[model samples]
Each structure stands twice: as structure tokens, then as C-alpha cells.
Target: MRVLLVEDNGDFALPCRQLLAALRGVQVVQTAASAQEACDWLRANPGGWDLVVVDLFLGQGHGFTVLRECAGRPPLQRAVVLSAYADETARQYARKAGADAFFSKTNEMDALLAYCLQLAGEVDGANR
Candidate 1:
């Protein structure tokens, strides 16, 4: 499986890479610090990526805007939102924008991993 992470913080991006690498199926992991960078990368890869993990507050452009773009593209629809700002309103926005899952950095890491695995179609989140 291939995954793309759009995160600006080095601390968060590093751990996300390690976690994706640790997963059994995930082999290729890519990172982009900004939404525009991610958009460009995805354009090059075009339906080649398995999943996309995006931060809600990207320090500049909003993740929702990127997701909106993804929704317009074909099956570029496998997306998840990961951020410290996991409020109900934010979650609703993500869901409306076509996110498969929404997670908080403060939540249990295991649960987050399980959710990601499920989103990647490797495992079932409901089984956890």
C-alpha cells in the first residue's frame, strides 16, 4: 500500500512515516508539507496512492479545500483527516468534504493506526 501524508510539522510527520512503515501492507509512504505540494504530487501519481492523511490546520491552506479538490477527481477519494483539532464541527466538515475517517493526535495511537489500516483496506476498524 502507498500512503501520502500532508503535514507541516516535522515531529508529527516523522512519527507518521514510522507508523506507516511499521504497518504490514504499507510499503511506500510520501510526505508533503503543504496542500499545494500534495496536490502536485497527487497529480503526478493520479489514482496511484492508496490513502491520504491530511492535517486540518495545515498552517496556511485548509485541508478541507484540498479534500474538495480530491472529491472532484476520480477515486482520488480515499482520504482521512488527522489533526489536533478534532472537534465535532471540524469532523462534520471533513465528512461533508468526503473524508473516510477523522482522528485526533491526542487520541490513542492504536485506534488511529487501526483506523488507518481499515482505510487502507487491510483490516476492519469495527473489529477493534
Candidate 2:
């Protein structure tokens, strides 16, 4: 499954990338720093990405715009919000905006990937 990781934090990006790299069947893993870049990439790579993992707080304005831009696309239906801000509002907004899952950056990324794998049927989900 091709995945796009939209995270601005370098520290978090590396380990996440490493973990995804270890997982099998994840063909294209691209990382973008901002909402604009992500939106542009998505438009250019439609039907190319299976999932988009985005951060709610992009250190800029609302990152919801990125999700909004991709929500209408068929292949972009699978999305997850990975953010450091673990607020109810953010979670609610992400869910309402069509995020398949909401994950705090501090949580186990394996769980996030497992969730994605489950939603996409590309890899083993964490279902015991």
C-alpha cells in the first residue's frame, strides 16, 4: 500500500519511516512537511496513494485543509490523523472530516500502521 506521511517533526518522522520500512507491502512512503505540499502531491499522485497519515497541528494553520482536499478522492478515502495534540476537538474534527483513525504521536506507531493495514487490507492487522 502506498502511504503519504505528512509530518513536520523530523524526530518523529524518522522512527515512523523506519517502522513503515520494516512493514511488508508498503510500496511508496512519502513524507511532506506542510499541508500545501501534501495537497499538491495528492493531486499529482491520485490513485497512487492508499493512505495518508497527517498531523492535525502542522505548526501552521489548521491541517484539516489537507484532509479536506483529499476526502473527495476515491483512492484517498483512507486517511488517519497522527498529531501531538490529543484534544477532543481535534479528534472529533478529524473523525468528522473522514479520518479512519486518530492517533497521538506519542502512541505506538505500530498500532497506527496496524489500523491502516486493517483498513487497506494490505498487511496484517493487530487482531491477535
Candidate 3:
């Protein structure tokens, strides 16, 4: 499974890559630091990506715009919000904006890993 991780902070981005590296058949194809960058990638690649892990706050633009860019993605493609701002309001807005799931960075790292693992399993199974 290919992933596009949209995170501007180096600290969080490194850890995220580390965690995702442990999963078999999962590769982070690219990392975008801003909403425009992510949107550009999406437009350039269309179905090139299988998953997008987005952080709400970016250095140059908001993750919400990135999420909006992911609207009407393919069935196998998913967009998830992995952010520090995982409050109820954020969750609701993320869902409305087009995130397939929302996971808090501070406390939900395990959940994020599990979600990725599940997708990897499905992808692996289908490939088999």
C-alpha cells in the first residue's frame, strides 16, 4: 500500500514514517508540507496513492483544504486526519471535510497504526 503523508513538522513526520515502516507492504510514497503541495500531488497522481495521512495544521496551509482536495477519492483510497487537534469539533469538521478517519497524535498513535495495519492486511489479501 502506498501512502502520502501530509505533515509539516519534522518531529512528528519522522515518528510517523518510523511507525509506518514497520508494516509490511506499506510504503510512504511522498510527504507534503502544505495544503497546496498535497493537492498538487493528488492532482498529479490521481489514483497513484492508496492512503493520505494529514495533519490539520501545516506550515503553509491548512489540512482542511487538503482533506477537501481528497473529496470523491477512489473506493480503495482513504484520507485520514492525524493531528494534535482531535477535539470533538475537529472530528466533526474533519468528517465533513472528507477524512475517512481521525486520530489524535498525542494519544491515538496506536489506533493510527492499527488502522494502517488493517488496510495493509486488506491490500495484501487482495493482492494474494
Candidate 4:
């Protein structure tokens, strides 16, 4: 599975990468630190990613913009919001903007990984 990870914190990236590495069938992972970069990457590689994991507060832009950019993606393409600000309001907004799931960085890391693994399994199964 190909993933585009949109996160700004260098501190968080390494841990996230390590977690992803433990998952089977996660072939390629890309990172973007800003909303503009995420949008540009999506445009440049249209229908190229299997999953997108985004943070709400970016160094340059918000994750909502990235969600909007992914609104028209294929059914197999998934977008999820993993943010520190995972309040009810933020969750609702993320869902409205087109996120498949919203997880809190403070407490829901395991859930996020499980969801990713589920998606990866589905993709791998379908490809076979």
C-alpha cells in the first residue's frame, strides 16, 4: 500500500514511520509538511496513493485543505485525520471535509495503526 503522510513535526514523523514499518504490505510512504505540498503531491500523482494520513495543524496549512483536495479520490483511496486536536467539533469537521476516520494523537495511535492495517489488508487481498 502507498501512503502519503502529511505531518509537520519532525519529532512525530520518525515514530509514525516506525509504526508504519511494522505493518505488512505498506510498500511506499511519502511525507508532506504543509497543505500546499500535500495538494501539489496529490495533483502530481493523481490516483497514485492508497492512503493519506493527515495532521490538522500543519507548519504552513491545515489538514482540512488536504481533505478537500482528496474529496474526489477513488473509492479505494482513503484519507484519515490524525491530529492532536481531536475534539468532537474537529472530528465532525474532518468528517464533513471527507476524512474516512479521525484519531487523536494523544490516545488513539493504536486505533490509527489498526485502521491502516485493515486498509492494507483489504488492498493486498484485492490485488491478489
* Lowest lDDT 10-residue stretch of candidate 1: 119-128
Model 1: per-residue Cα lDDT over 13-121, one tens digit each? 9988898778876654578888888878888887667778888888768788667757755453478888899889999999999887888888856776886666556
Compute the lDDT of residue 8 as modeled in candidate 1: 89
The C-alpha stretches of model 1 lying farther than 4 A from their native spots are 72-77, 121-128
Winning model by TM-score? 4
Q: Write the per-residue lDDT of candidate 3 for residues 17-96, one digit (tens) a residue.
A: 87887788889999998899999999999978888999999989999999999888877789999999999999999999
Native-to-model Cα distance after best TM-score fit, residue 105 in candidate 4, in Å: 0.4
The list of candidate 4 runs beyond 4 A from truth reads none
TM-score winner, 3 or 4:
4
Q: Estimate each model's TM-score.
A: 0.85, 0.84, 0.95, 0.96
Lowest lDDT sum, 10 consecutive residues, model 4, at: 20-29
Task: Spell out the clash pairs found in candidate 4.
Answer: none
What is candidate 1's TM-score against the reference?
A: 0.85
The weakest ten consecutive residues by lDDT in model 2 span: 119-128
Evaluate all candidate structures by whole-model CA lDDT and list the values in order.
0.77, 0.76, 0.91, 0.91
